[model samples]
Target: MSLCYCNSQKSFKDCCEPYIKGLKNAPTAEALMRSRYSAYATHQADYLVATTHLSQRALYPKEDILLWATSNQWQKLEVLKSTPTTVEFKAYYLDQNKIPQIHHEFSTFVQEEGIWYYVDGEYR
Candidate 1:
């Protein structure tokens, strides 16, 4: 089995697939963050949009999200820190021009009714 795109050292089916597939909810902010990274790697734009907080959904249209996800060659994810409501991480990828790039962000998340949704981030 292939390893998860999140570099979780576990098989995709075991690590993030269930969340991406909508079969399960991510239990923590960190888990949601890791699964979101995997969604980018797998080009699952719907998952990304669905997991975004509703108030911020308009800020990230599905088309834009799809383009961003498909334009990159996702490499790996490095989670720097995780708290109850935040996750700081670096996502490495090759951009459209095939240049290596890093998207670093300290992301915020909110849980409503036991479901975690991405709110926004402070890019660094």
Candidate 2:
């Protein structure tokens, strides 16, 4: 079994695949964050777009999201903290030039109609 891209130590199928495949919704903000990281690693731009909060969707065009996803070689995800509606994490990746980079953020989430959507993030 392939390990989840989110570094959750679970199989991809058991962790993020269901979320990415539209078969299930992430039950919590942290889950959503993990699955979103997995989406980037897998280059599933549509999933990324669909999981963003509606109000912020326009700011994240699918083509741009896809380009960002495909341009990086996602390496790891580190979940530093989580609350009901927030997650702080670091995403490690390699750029197209093969240079290592880290994207650190404290992300906010909101649950609407029992579904969680990523709102925005404060970059660190």
Candidate 3:
């Protein structure tokens, strides 16, 4: 089975490839949010850090992030709403013990040098 999102018609790679590779800027806050979801699903921590605003990136520890990613089976991502600087969504997944869980949040983003970078989020 293949996993894809964002109505991009392309696979996650082809769709969000540039963002993941630091080759292109995310056009909207929602785009950044979706790419972050894909990053979490793939356990691409370096990409995560790269896309996060430097001021807030310190909130997460790399080792703990890797552990969390390894312990979860990411299922799907849903974007409920978004604006130029914020996005609200829910990501569903299963834990290491196979317990299903949902992480819902309203995430904020900022544009720097024409690139969108995640700032922080309010979990809901």
Candidate 4:
């Protein structure tokens, strides 16, 4: 599908493909957030955990996430505001059951060495 971010110039496959496939690293929190959204859309659980903070990595279940992704369709992403280690955005999508949903949240992230990691998020 076409993406609203990146000026709608690229499909999720072309724009965030590397990061979603665990072939490329996300250098920033916002970039990781974007790639994670793409991963969810594509059901790439391995990529999700790979980009997450090591401390919190255990909180996620790869299989469960894969199942959840199968039932959802990611539609759009909006990074309303962001800093080097944080981001506030709205992610829009539709559940497989066809329910539309919007996750508006302020997400916190941290960088260790040179890798960015998702810390937590609060709904807004």
Candidate 5:
């Protein structure tokens, strides 16, 4: 079975694909963060953009995101702390130069009409 990009110990199809495919909405900020990490791994740039809060979408134009996502080899994701509308996490990956890297961030989320959206993140 292909494990999820978030390393959630579940198959990709059983984990993030549904969110990426628009089959369901992420239930919380942490869940949205996990699915977004998976979207990067799978090169689903559109899903990444679509899930972002509209006010924040300008920061992640699809072309730029596609370029970034395709350039890295995403390794795994760890959820450090999660609240009702925020999540702190670490995403591990290898850059194009093959250097190991970790993106640690405290992210905020907003939910509207029962759909969660990524708002912004602060690097740590």
Candidate 6:
């Protein structure tokens, strides 16, 4: 059983994969944030794009996203805070140079028609 990348103590299939694969929708902003981290870890650019708010899509051109997503070796993810529409998390990973790094961000999300979408984030 492949464990999920989001540090959720759940199988990939039982955790974020369902959201990434469109089999289900994330119920909260924190869930969406975790799933997005899982998408980045797994190099699922399409899922990342699909879960992004339409207005924010243009900021992340596919090539740039693919480049970043493919270059990282994701290690750990920790959610620091969450609200109805925002979540803060820290993700640890290795860069293309194999240097360890941390990504800490406060993310905003929105729900439209019962589907949650990532809006933007502020890096820490």
Provide the TM-score for each candidate, comma-separated: 0.99, 0.99, 0.89, 0.84, 0.97, 0.96
The lDDT, on a scale of 0 to 1, for candidate 5 is 0.93
**Model 4: how far residue 39 lies from native, Å:** 0.6
| Candidate 1, superposed: residue stretches over 4 Å from native | none
Residues 17-60 of candidate 1: C-alpha lDDT, one tens digit per residue: 99999999999999999999999999999999999999999999
- lDDT string for model 4 (76-119, tens) is 77789988888898888787778999989999998888777888
Q: Listing every candidate in turn, what is its Cα RMSD in Å to the true structure after a full C-alpha superposition?
A: 0.5, 0.4, 1.9, 2.4, 0.7, 0.8
Across 1-124, the per-residue lDDT of candidate 2 in tens digits comes to 9999999999999999999999999999999999999999999999999999999999999999999999999999999999999999999999999999999999999999989999999999
Model 4 misplaced stretches (Cα beyond 4 Å): 1-8, 11-14
Q: Write the per-residue lDDT of candidate 6 for residues 1-124, one digit (tens) a residue.
A: 9988999899989999999999999998888989999999888899989899999999998778888999889899999999999998999999989999999998999999999999999999
Summing lDDT over every window of 10 consecutive residues in candidate 2, give the lowest-scoring window: 42-51
Q: Write the per-residue lDDT of candidate 5 for residues 1-124, one digit (tens) a residue.
A: 8999887899999999999999999887888889999999999999999999999999889999999999999988989988999999999999999999999999999999999999999999
TM-score of 3: 0.89
* Per-candidate clashes, comma-separated: 0, 0, 0, 1, 0, 0
Q: Is candidate 3 or candidate 5 better by lDDT?
A: 5
lDDT tens digits, residue span 1-124, model 3: 2446444456876667668778777788888888878777778788888788999878877777777877898888888988999999988999998999999999989999888899999999
